[model samples]
Target: MTWQRPASVPVGQVWSRFKGRERDGQPAKMSNWERYIAQGVSLACFTETDGAPDELVAFNITLDLVDVFTLYGVDRYLTSSGLTVLPEHRGQNIGARLFEARKPLCAALGIQCTATVFTATASQVLASKCGYTQLAELSYSHMAARGVDLSGCATPTAKLMGTKFHFD
Candidate 1:
């Protein structure tokens, strides 16, 4: 899990080499299309070494919600940039804690709702546990017809999930 792309490896060579790698019966890496959507404000958790953060263990990025204004009836909701936890840190509830932290963040940003397209079943489950409800669902096959291929994913379908945050 401590991956360092060696100088000899091409820019994406390491990723390409392990593109089909699976963990816990699911693909460990995301498709390039999904990677394109992962850019935005990042929230991260790091492990301390000598009382200073030394390694990023988990992270979730937030971006302005897009194309789903009609679904939530708002144009300014927060959405996922992407969420990831180091493979070594998996199964430790770190991902759930990150989602829980978003509530306070949303309130501070004056954003009332949050939404995301959960391309993995595990993420959809986590979203549900975080109180997000399914707003829509699309099959990977359907997405492929539109020019984005998500055929080799763990789940046949992806879900659009959303939730409203209450600020005191």
Candidate 2:
């Protein structure tokens, strides 16, 4: 079945300004998350709770990375904008289920590929288990060299994982 966002749930946006040595202390790059949400889709996992029948446990937002993938000979693909699983829901396989669900969603949408930047070690492992191949990797120390201090972060590296769906 095709998915449609509920009308009652409005998509929100936030503007991010990047400044530092990477940008030479200038606003070289800016991002609006809502724009991505508007242009793409979000998948969520919910559970029944004592207080709330439908409690959000996990979610993943994806956006089309046509511009970035074109150079690689990929016409279009869904690139993860964000992914999260509630702390209390961790270890329940909800995140893995969410990652797995993307296949049917992509087939329904006529999209052939999906990709994500897995910054957490657990997520990278999950992606590997889900059949996503590592396309590239970026280490936190490398980011620090580029002036982005990701020191003290629990994740030491980020990997770009992608898969091409073979819909039946």
Candidate 3:
């Protein structure tokens, strides 16, 4: 399979499908969507066969951030977001293939790749398999905001952490 970043492809189609279902009660904010389109590039993986859209099994969004500077000599953090494989295409290692295609794109942009996964079992497994590490675990005060009970949980807030993969 080969992956290419085509400028004419409709990235919003895949992004809306994945993100709309993930976040409830709100359309993906248009401003954020625009920013993503401006700051990120979309990759599509396809088979060699002609007219084989079905073989176009995976999609990813890689965001480039060059405005922030850190001591590690890193200026960009490439985020891998909205990774989705067709339902019939699961268990085929397509996700890993899609990620492998992204490495060169990150290097070309001079960015350190990272992704954030919520406290979900599947996400944690996939992120770890993709070479991401757990940088920090965070807690939130849900009761104060959402007025919900989180007695058994350590904290109502979700975890937010950073992970890095270097291509050099």
Candidate 4:
């Protein structure tokens, strides 16, 4: 149950090759792939790593400014694109913990948090656990209109959820 804390992102694929050739024979000093390494303010986790603690996550994020408001609108917020815990990690409440981790990062910038997920109780439960309320639920066919491509989705519906927060 050892979780490797967040650290600088590993040298990226493009950069790794650059370093490989530049420092021939010398290994690149990169960060470990596990536990829940935070790169900047990204809400992410690694469920698999090299000999590292079983990093757990099936999540994606969108940092673009979501137009979730019209009156008294805000600019940007952390979007939890998806959070699918591995089958083995089910019932562990990892999603809740991960979402909890995202709060402060947003609060520091005075921004709210949002998420979109299918009707599945799992994700809805996670969102609820994180204090987000459902704003709407859309059909999978409409995903493309919302800039979603569900060819990779396991379900047909994803709910839009959000919550207000402050640093104080």
- lDDT (Cα, tens digit) per residue for candidate 1, span 1-168: 222323442331111000112335322433343354233234566655575555455667766544446755665677775688877678777777878766756565556788888988899999999899999999989999999998889999989898987777
Model 2 lDDT tens row, 1-168: 344543443443211111111112221222453354564457665543463324444567776554546423567677785687766556667677777777766665667888888887888898999899999989999999999887876898889998888877
Q: Which lDDT value does model 4 have at 130?
A: 76
**Candidates 1 and 3: which is better by lDDT?**
1
TM match of model 3 to true structure: 0.56
For candidate 1, the per-residue lDDT at 25 reads: 39
Query: What is the C-alpha local distance difference test score of each model?
Result: 0.66, 0.65, 0.50, 0.52
Tell me which residue pairs clash in candidate 3. Answer: 140-157
TM-score of 2: 0.69
Q: Model 3 over residues 29-133: C-alpha lDDT tens digits?
A: 122333434544665544333533333445565655554535335655656566666554466666666666566565554456554533544555666687666
- Once superposed on the true structure, which residue ranges of model 3 sit more than 4 Å away at CA? 1-40, 51-55, 67-73, 138-168
Report the Cα RMSD per candidate: 11.3, 12.4, 9.7, 12.2
After TM-score superposition, what is the CA distance of residue 49 in candidate 1 from its true location, in Å? 2.9
- List runs of model 4 lying over 4 Å from the truth: 1-39, 45-68, 117-119, 141-156
lDDT of 4 by residue, 41-106 (tens): 445444333634233243434343545464326655556444655554446565666666566655
